[model samples]
Target chain A: MTKTHYFYIGYGLLCLLGITSPLLNPWEGATTVWDRLYLKFYGVSPYGGFSLLSFLFYSIIYTGFLYQFQLFLTDYLSGRFYYTAIRYQSLARWFIHLGWQMSYKAACFLVVLATVTVLIGLALGDSPELTVSVLSNLTVIQLLIQFLLNGWLQLMNGLMIVFITAWVFKEPSYNLIAMGLLTIAALPVLNAGGWLPAGLNSTAYLSGQWEDLILITMKLVVYLLIQLVVIAVLFKRKNIAFY
Target chain B: MKLIEVVNVSKSFKGIQIFNQANAVFEQGNIYGILGPNGSGKSVLFKLICGFIKPDQGDIIIHPSYRSRRADFPQNFGIIIDRPGYAAGLTGFENLKRWAEIRNQIKDEDIKRTMRVVGLDPDARQKMKSYSLGMKQKIAFAQAIMENQQVLILDEPFNAMDVDSVKVLRELLIKYKQEGRTIILTSHNEEDIELLCDQVYQIRSHKLVPVNTMAKV
Candidate 1:
């Protein structure tokens, strides 16, 4: 099998483990691995702790990063797909060529993941009342909007990191690490300096008060513009043959 | 009429000069071969014509009908520079299909025919990662010729091919030229230069100079 097959298989197994672990052990597993990682690294978890909503939010963000990383690895191994796509001058095709479909599939996977976690969380009676209140307080419409907006923001962030790394290093692993370090370093400064709005300051945007919605939306727009500008500059200045 | 004109172009990378005040013209419906030692800027010259890279100090003018003054790539051209890259996860046919979608001028049958012409089996299921070097070269050739572009720029197009494949490609080049397509190629192989090209030039001292075809042959 090709390396791509292996990558998909590995990703499938990870999603399976993340989903099933909750059913097997209710108290710990339903909180998506990303939330756990965020808790470990940043000393903060989305929504103040683990909940069904936080799990879904973190899973979506994690999926974005994983999808971007897969694209990076694919480009590194093939050395032709991204370059050829750029030469054709179609941004949509370029995204499709680099596995943008996977990100959409990841969204579907998160839905399934959230449902399974909710079912298992209720069945196991692990803070069932808390899950109930969380589900009720956030209506389906609000939840859907949050999912779509937050997922887009995460995907944009992921793409920006990949584009910046491709511009500078053109290597996948190093780029991933560099992006990680840069984010970790930048977030604290952005947060402390009050450059970002309160709702945009942390992954806690999922539970942000309704009044902060406008601020969050504006932040998303600004991030999207930055992503487009970065991609345009990268394509315009960088030589295809060099990569 | 001139199909491409590179007027007083100069290029350098990281302070290393590749070409200095290089000027060359390619006429319509002729096969032009560039002969130079490795790193003599043969590929760079072809890239400039294709608009893959900008020259440090000159303008490359393609026929007005084909491209605008500031376009980065010519509108009707096929090119293979350095090693051809395709998606490793995609089958040979799929890679070509994706590229054909970008051009939107060729159908599936065209891609199949081009693959067959290049001696590649379009039905082959193996991804590009599993392809041998010769197979990769053939796939690259297939992509370049599939769209039936008016101009072709091929750098070292015959690399890693067997004798028979090379012969087939030479015939294909002749066929392309016969159809009034302007073809630009670079080669270190004197036999290739002699057998295929209508006019030959060698890069000497960072400039293109016409060589005696009779003397090279």
Candidate 2:
């Protein structure tokens, strides 16, 4: 099987393990393998035994990794495709225009993913209080806006990393290490600065923290616009010859 | 009328000069051959005309009527330069389909017809990664002509093709020329140049020197 297929299988198994482990060992003091695994990674006790929160956090981070992996794969494949497509003299400018096309696709994928995950969460009979509180705190429109903002930010971040690395490195493989380093370095800053709203932090927006949401949304938009302009200008000036 | 004019174009890579004050002109409805040895700026010239690279000290001007602007690619351009790259996981038809979707100028039948013209199996399910070198070349050719563009710029397009395939492609190109499309091709093959080009220029000393095939004959 392809690496992507293996990844999906492994991710699905992990999700199943996360959900079922808590149910299997429901006693307050009893600890399951999932709890132990979570402790090892998080260095904290899993709240509520087989905590759905912990599982959700793990899933979000894993999804980020998956998104990055797919971005890398698509960039590599599209670069190869563009290497020849650009040869079609009329398509020489296509590399610059690809940003919007990819962003649109990523946005659609994010919406579908969010809807499916929410549906699955409902089906799994998540905590009644958790679901009620979440639903009560934010209307559907607010939730959608937040979800779209979060997805756009994620997409912009991924694109920025690829574009910056592509500008610097001649080989696409070199950008993998650069992407890893950038993600590692950016995560702590984004979290500490309250830029990224994953896990429990994401729940804050539902409780009428519109100010923070608006501020973050504005910053992300400005940053993405600047990055897009830089990428377009650089690509226009760069010589794209296959070696 | 001139379709493309390259005026005093100069280009270099990390201090290695490729072209210095090189100039060339291509008129409409003519097959122009650029003849040069390897690493002699034939490909560079093609890249300049295609707006793939910027010239250091000059401008490439595509006729305003043919192209929208001075800085943009000419409208309806079909080109094959270097190696043809495609998504490794996609079938040949899928790859072509993606490109066709971009412009929305051609239909599925056009794609299939071009594939047939290039002797590629349109229904083949094999991924592009598994395609042989000859198959890849044929697919690239299929992409170039599928749109029925007014201009074609091909760089060593016949590389890795068998004799029969090459003959078929040559005939196809001749047909494109007869239909009044401007075609520019770079080749080391003398026979291709003799049989195909209406006007030929040899790349000499970073400048184009016109060749008279009839005088030589």
Q: Candidate 1 lDDT, tens digit per residue, A72-140? A: 454653446433643454434465555465456546654654555556544545443322233224333
True contacts kept of each: 0.27, 0.27
In the order shown, the candidates' Cα RMSDs to the true structure are 5.1, 6.0
Residue B143 local lDDT, model 2: 81
How well is each residue in B76-141 modelled by candidate 1, as lDDT tens digits?
A: 777777777877778999999988887688899999999999999999899888899999888888
List candidate 2 stretches off by more than 4 Å.
Answer: A1-97, A108-125, A128-148, A167-170, A187-208, A235-238, B69-71, B188-190, B209-217
Q: What does candidate 2's lDDT look like per residue over A106-168, in tens digits?
A: 677556545544554446554323222323344444555555665467555666656556654
The CAPRI-style docking tier of model 2 reads acceptable
Candidate 1 off by > 4 Å: A18-140, A168-174, A182-190, A193-203, A234-238, B68-71, B214-217
Q: Model 1, DockQ value?
A: 0.41
Which number leads on DockQ? 1
List the pairs of residues colliding in candidate 2: none
Please provide, for model 2 over B1-217, each residue's C-alpha lDDT reduced to its tens digit, 9 standing for 90 to 100.
7999989888987798888888889998899998888988887888788776789989898887766643345567787776676777899999889888877889999999899999998999999988999998888788878988788899888988999999999998898888888999987778888888998888888787788965532
C-alpha lDDT of residue B158 in model 1 = 93
